[model samples]
Target: MGQKIIRFSDLTGTHVENDDDLVRIVVRQHPDLEDGPVEIEALGGELTAVEELALDLVTIELHRPGADEPETVVLEAEAFDRLASATPMAEVLRGAKKVACPIPSQTAVPAGAKERVNYASLEHAGRPHKGRTTDAEKQLVRQHLDRINERLAAEGVRTIDLGNAEHVVRYGLEALARERGVTLG
Candidate 1:
């Protein structure tokens, strides 16, 4: 009555970026099995059609027992190559299946929203900073594209064609410095 050998210590590998045949593995579990119960498999193929890009390339951790943290399991690269060609890895981690990792929240932008400006740095700030292009810098780039078309007509958008004057002052000062979050430097 003895079969509790769960030794799968750190064995990392990564090569993902436009999928160069995919490869991303991260394992850890040398001596920490509290609620012990994990399993995974996908030996090389048949990952159910890129199951979300092979579960973004596995990452499992389990160390329960008065746990403060340690119970993560993220595998998809064909269930991490079927638990790396499982042979006796606790019968593919006891038929692994316990995934639920999604904690990312930080979205709050509505107070006069509009922050995302980098039109190639406002097209190099409408060029000509000592690189030649004067007439008082084309009338200060036409008064900064008429103050970004008066803040795009108070954010109603649709007014950026001062007759191609330096591409409408580099996209109307990059849409008035991204709707006013301003930081043209």
Candidate 2:
């Protein structure tokens, strides 16, 4: 399940000003976009972020890769210090994973195949405005939390901690803890 770039060409400097322009060019070059979700990208775009001169607060949005929407992890000074002094990210971050893209890519491969496109490729092309997961998706994940936590723990990654507020909100930890005779913070 991987994507192969079929074609590559460079547009003029003035062409493709933004994500909208990139989509327009993609549509213009390959008129088959209406048939499926054509993968598109615009290189050399500016990186945007906030950098305060004297910062007191820090927050990071982590797309911790399963199908769920990214979580906003607020970092305390101690937490940041621990992370900063941790081992290499590749060894520490065993939980993050790359999954199937939401966009239905216009692939030459047959239907029901995976990885024609990915979140990173389509990120600059402007993703559709979809919100968080539905209640059904949440329920399905909830049913497997025990097994999931076990596997995650074995991998040395921290399990979904009911003590963490973000995890509680994301996984409905209070009800889940009550169901399993566990306590929460």
lDDT of 1 by residue, 84-164 (tens): 563755566678786666555445555898663322232322332323332333334444666645655666665555444
Best by lDDT: 2
The per-model lDDT (C-alpha) reads 0.44, 0.48
Q: In model 2, where do residues sit more than 4 Å from their true spots?
A: 1-137
How many clashes (backbone N, Cα, C below 3 Å) per candidate? 7, 0
Highest TM-score: which candidate?
Answer: 2
Where does candidate 1 stray beyond 4 Å? 1-61, 64-67, 77-90, 93-185
- Candidate 2: 10-residue stretch with minimal lDDT: 119-128
- Measured with C-alpha atoms, the lDDT of residue 111 in candidate 1 is 80
Which ten residues in a row are the worst by lDDT in model 1? 8-17
